[model samples]
Target chain A: MSLLRLRRASLSYPAGGGSVEVLRDVDLTIRRGEFVTVLGRSGAGKTSLLNLAAGFVAPSSGAVEVDGRPVTGPGADRAVVFQDDALLPWLDASENVAFPLRLKGAGRAERLERAAALLRLVGLEGHERKNLWELSGGQRQRLGIARAIAAEPEFLLMDEPLGALDAMTRDRMQELLLKVWRASGAGALLITHSVEEALFLGTRVVVMEPRPGRIGLDEGLDFSARFLEGVPARALKAEPAFIAARERLIAAIHAEEAA
Target chain B: MTVSATNLPERAASRFPSGGRPALPAAFLRRLPVFAALFTLTAVFGLWWIASARGWAPPVFLPSPDRVWKAAQIAADTGYASATLGQHAAASLGRVMAALLVTLLIAVPAGFVLALSPVGRGLLDPLIEFIRPLPPLAYLPLVIIWFGIGEGSKILVISVAMFAPIAISTAFGVGSASESQVRAARSFGASRFQTLRHVLLPAALPSIISGVRIALGAGWTTLVASELVAASRGLGYMIQSAAQFLVTDMVIVGILAISLFAFGFEILFRLIERFWLPWSRRR
Candidate 1:
């Protein structure tokens, strides 16, 4: 199986006098079809980690590689969904989804057909012709996911893409994200502040501690797999084992914060 | 436009005024400003008519409304200086449009260069700043001396006046593209060219259209001034000639023609914007 590996990666930025290290010697590896969630507090450099994987930022040390090949910069192999959705306002919904295909030089008709299919898959059926401004926050985030998968990327890197949604919408989107990840067959690296979300969505939840950001906990869970195996989201969330895992992750993040 | 239910029934009834009497037409209330504009125009024209008819001002200085109207009819029919009013209007419009096209072609790319590249901005920034404040007329003599009294020189002078507004606005629009927007495109492996075309260009379009409107305004003024110097078949030239001969009515007719054409262009631009960038205003 293909894998994305960030081996002892470090990132820093210039500050007054000396440089400030935002992420230091963080080692992470994601296997194909795996869902990896990076949970963190405000200053945890969780976004920085996602950026590193997406090749938007270079590591100050070590490497980010795909299948042992060094990742140079953002390429077609990785697609990112941003927190704000970032759907191009100028294009209609389908056209926005087709944008990555367009960049890959896909023909017009093929691009349209693929975009229509993807939008339908993302539960935006009949919204193909609508302007992006007409979409609700949740719908736009769904479109963002559709666009990310349109590239048929090996990795889907998302940075709190559902952060702006209401509680109800966020719950629905979490399930939708699980379905998309399975359908796309891409390794997922998602960053979020919600501990329950990390637990529910991720096959492996890696909690990052802030202030010289580093991964404080890396634990594997089968909740996402269980959800796929006919377990309803509500039932799974209310399970005693699920609660224990959620509480443990929360405690771990809080302890890291206090320390 | 929905009428949501109100809590206070008494206040709602009072607002409508008992016996189920209807309120004023919504259209009338909406069109109040338009009616006010018409009234203002009528009042201004009424004052001008009375002033000229009562000889409150010299006829040569302010011709009567009828005299100006007659002059307009004559200019349209019999022509002025071997060219009819239509021809003069067309000539002026053609010059401005040509200048606008040339300005857009150059300025948009220049704007991207200015915004995207430090070296390019360093080189072009001071030059744009220098060109922006000075009026086209300031360089008209220079252009005439260098390029002579050709149509090219006229178009060149007008285009220069049109440049800064468009270029600066384009740069501003490009800058307004959010970081996530560009990064999303880049994540799809969009090349530099693709990013600019699919991402930055559309992002910049609304501002570019507004800049074109401002550039057109600047170009119109420059066209008039340039024609005042060395043009034979434009509204400005007709106005200049009519003024020299003390034909105040013809001059007024010329001025009205220019105003009408400019207003028409503004409406045309609005329609174009609505057609192409429909989401711009909605967003």
Candidate 2:
């Protein structure tokens, strides 16, 4: 509930005849109410970093710990929002959201109530019974979040949840994400290739380096915090300070790629 | 061909005052395939009628459609080989459906195991492959020897013939779940069983329905082969009896009945798919 930490974690996959190191002694942490955005070029182990934190893959060296306990496998404490949305097409909106509850052995009535409430929380109340295919990419992503949060996990791990949305919807979804984060008070770790998205959303942003991926830069930012303090997202993002930081992160990623 | 030309913004409606002969009416054009089917049936029937009337071979060899129809009426009245046409038809249908049910229960679970567990696949994959290519006739005698020439053996023969398609298709459907989908389920604390139930099962449904479609065809075909061994009341038995006595019209009637019944079930399964997995149609 308080802290999720990766303590010098590394992962490598046996490929061909040799092993390819995916993450090299990566160190990171997210506290409750903190939104940590990871930004990097492709192959920078951004996803591997999240996978370690979410316990989808075991770190070959060191450890991922939520609070202080070592992470072993995927659990109810860590829910992930996949880039592809990954909502079951066979399930309607409400049923998809209710899935986590069902897995946890919640009774049908309780699951339905929780799902219906989460649908409202995600601004998908009226579309509860709608098929997943009928929902737009943005709406489906929102439903994915609802499903992820259905179990009230300690942390929310998202892999480019809004990466597929059109520009207008992406911008709108960014604000919605902040709203949900503020409401849930769950620690969040999101990875994206977009520097502006990283700069705009993260309370702390971590930039990753590729080819034996490692952390290149880690810093705290006040933009998302300020937005949560009732500043309009557009006005805050248009600020000169925001523009300067976005440029700096973009430069860092490109500079790493060139290296 | 002129669709693009007529749709251009620069074109005026008056440029084609009659809308190009009304384009053969959209509904009528849509039914063109139906017309083609009807035409083919009629042409075949006409050719057969003409051939029989002119003594093309002998009525004993190629019976006219009316002769087949009269044979059907006569079978309905006097029965064939100790059973009426209705009874024979019912017996054939019952055997196939029983085999289908048995195969579905066994084969679907076998499919799930073969797909989910490597050891299960290792154990079952070769067996399914072994049964897949074995014609029902090849196995019918073996089944009769094992289970005896009773309803059980006949059903078993048909069920074994259906086993491979249903099981293989189930495995194929189970494999269709995306990596992220499985990962998502696990992240929600879904156990292996829960994941299989919630994600893999529904994901496999469209494929399972299709597998059943193929399996039903196998079931019907194998029903005839199975009935070859001491079947007293089936369309296949009636046809076999008719063939021995040179009742060519009755044989034609049996073949037509089987074909029509198979075609009817195919349509029925399609409608079930439409109703149950309506989302599958989006693809």
Candidate 3:
């Protein structure tokens, strides 16, 4: 069975008088350990799709399932890293990262040890004591990623985690995310407005449309050259093949908007 | 608009250190003029004390500092004619704490319910609004009727005084918890109770602590009114009895002691707040 599935999912929110549809009959599936990137413009329901998978919002119709089990609500098996860091303001870096495990009643020592490892994974080794406010924007976002992955869930859902970061930080985060995903081998569904990011990280990229949001196109990515060795993500971004793929995805998004 | 550093005169520092230190002592030394004024006032008081010893002012009207100090010692020795200052202070502290505890136990949960449940807020908010504006002193007669002229009456009076401030502050705090924080907690598979414990309460802490500070001040003021009715052993009772006997020095001592207690409590609360919420100290 596919590790996760969304069958004809549609989400709607109450508008001025009638409900405004955000997603419409969106069907997607991923096998175990696959990386799927969802690409679209702002308000394209890419986030809504991720939110459905995260169980932040219930779909109006159809179903969201994880590993053949219905995703009736958020569960431990699926962990989400929101676009905004959403780190609890009162907690310092270590506590925030250890929160999910703390909820599951892990011993304090084990939780801290695991959280420290993940913090080191995200290059935040010495920032365990710094309060959320004291962190730079990029550091806070990295903490958000660390927190999400701390549980080492079967599936990871990221909603444009690096959108708010500067170009340098965002690029750095992309490489870090790929490295973490490679090491953990967790199935990841990433949602992003950045086409270049989708092309780089996703094993399969699903394009989405706006208004009544729906999936428009689906394409597979080839990371064949670096399949054995770690892919240098920045150098790949400047390559002709990667740029051509990015242009194609950008064109697809704009075409849907124009239509 | 460019400013030239050359146009400004440079001042020499007594001891300058590079980097690391924040110059906190320099900030303190900047307030020397205010400290000097206070020192001058103390010197003037000493001059008056010497003049009073030489009969510069009537002894009956203006008791010499030495005489007042001697009387204070005598009062201490006699245990304030019945109860010692220690006894009075204990009674006052006990009553205030008891009242505050009862007030918080009822008010905080009530505030949370009122903030979260629309039905509860609607049903209770109007009644709370109605009762709140009525001053704590105005409840004295009712409390006396209900609890009689005893410890119960005094506690009821202080609790009533503190209840409104605590409730209002708690409700405001809970009502104003950041929406995003609640949303974030909920998205993490947390149920409603978990959200309340993990997100709402912690977020509301700063406001609730401020409310406690304000409520403590109100409770202290209510102690005066509470004792005025039928109390025999407190700072208020001491002051009132001294006033009747025309012992202004004793009255002043009582007043000073009460003020001192209030000031001490405020400092204690501020220290606790700093320890608990260091994030708020900068702002």
Candidate 4:
């Protein structure tokens, strides 16, 4: 079953005297264990689509459903990794991961134990007590991912989760994300402007266009599975097939610009 | 070869031929501001002593440091204006603290409400602005007439003085809570009250604490002024009566006592800010 589905969803905001359409007739879906990436230029409403899936915003028309149930508002079933890695500053690393469990009324010992396990899964085993400011940017993002998965949500919605990181850190995070996604088996819809990242991490990639944004291309690829089968990221990127796919995705985006 | 020759002299000069003095130890550098402050304080006192000794101002008016010291000892041991120095100081402190307690109890929750809800802010913003700028003393006449020159009136005056700063800062703090933090909380399925408790409250705490500190100072100032007009027991009362009687020594003692109390409270607030909100200090 599809973990999340957006059916002909449209979103618009009131601007000056009339409405400015951000997304129009946007249909997307993420089945269980599938890794989906949405690629677009700025103002292409990729984020608006993600917000609709997360139920952070409502569509002006059509439906956003999770597991056949319509999404009316945000719920624990869907978790978001925000662009800025918005971990609560007052809470230390472990406490931040444990926050959602606490919201669900889990006991102290249980939540702490679960949080420590999630932190360890994200490779932050011993840095449990470090404050948010003390953690480097990449570490903060890892903590955000840990917190997102701590609730065991069926779907993870990430909006430019690696956009703030340096190249080396982003590369390492991309590998880590594949490992976590494969292990958790939770469907993911990641939005980004990076073609390399979209190709490397996604089992399926969707390209979007702006000015009443709509999906431009939807393609299925096996790169993420090939990486899982022990094809190293560096080696895969240098392959002629990988290069060709990357070019095709870029061209699809440019086609939207020309249109 | 020419470039090498020029570079050798530049390197040698940078390494060993400097004319500047050696750098001071970190400990001494850190204490430099303290030393400067002490020097300035001592110079002011020395000037006062020299002027008094040279009869720059008559002893009856200025009263030498020795006379003030003697007055302090006398007030501490016997009494000042029918009450000992401790009693007078305590009276003023008690009124300020009482008013502060009332202000905290009322203003903090009110501030949070105003911050969290636009309707609450709309209702309260005008009233807060109107009351904030009017001097606590401006309401003195109305307070005295209503509550009758007693402890009630004086406490009410100080409480009125304190309420504005605490409420304003809390509202500002709540308003300033980062959007990302609030969104993160909501995404985790936290309700509005839970978001306030876990996110907004902690984010706004540093501002709220600083506001309370400002309100304390304002409340103290208003307490003294209120006591001057009505009360018979506080330091302000002692100083006003002593001035009328031309007892310059007693007046000096009252002023010094008030200064000492204010200084002590400032230290206490600083320590609380350091200990309770260490994360706020990091930024």
Q: DockQ, in order, for the candidates?
A: 0.80, 0.73, 0.39, 0.60
On DockQ, the leading prediction is 1
The stretch of ten residues in a row with the least summed lDDT in candidate 2 chain A is A250-259
Position B154, candidate 2: lDDT: 88
Better of 1 and 2 by lDDT: 1
Off by over 4 Å in 1: B1-25
Task: Point to the candidate with the largest lDDT.
Answer: 1
Candidate 1, residues A1-259, lDDT tens digits: the string is: 8899999999999999889999999999999899999987888899999999999999999999999999999987889999998888888898899999999889989988999999988999999999988889999999999999998999999999989899999999999999999999999999988888998999999989888999889989898999999899999999999999988888888995466
Colliding residue pairs in candidate 1:
none
| lDDT by candidate, in order shown | 0.89, 0.88, 0.78, 0.86
Error of 2 at A61 (Å): 2.1
TM-score leaderboard ranking: 1, 2, 4, 3
Candidates ranked, most accurate by lDDT first: 1, 2, 4, 3
Worst 10 residues of 3 chain B by lDDT: B1-10
Off by over 4 Å in 4: B1-27
RMSD of 1: 5.3
DockQ of 1: 0.80
- Write one digit per residue (lDDT tens) for candidate 3, span B1-283: 1111211212223344335865567656566455666788799888869878888878766777776677666556675636776666677778889999999998888788788899998987887887777777788888898889998889888988888778877888786666545655555556778778877787667767777878888988888788777777887777677778877677666666777887798778777766887654332
DockQ order of candidates, top first: 1, 2, 4, 3
Model 2: per-residue Cα lDDT over A1-259, one tens digit each = 5889999999999999999999999989899899999998899999999889888899999999987989889988888999998888877888899999889788978988999999998899899789977888899999999899986888999999999889999988998898888888899999987888888899999999998999998999999888889998889889999999988888888895566
Q: What is the lDDT of residue A68 in candidate 4?
A: 80
For model 4, what is the alpha-carbon lDDT of residue B151?
A: 90
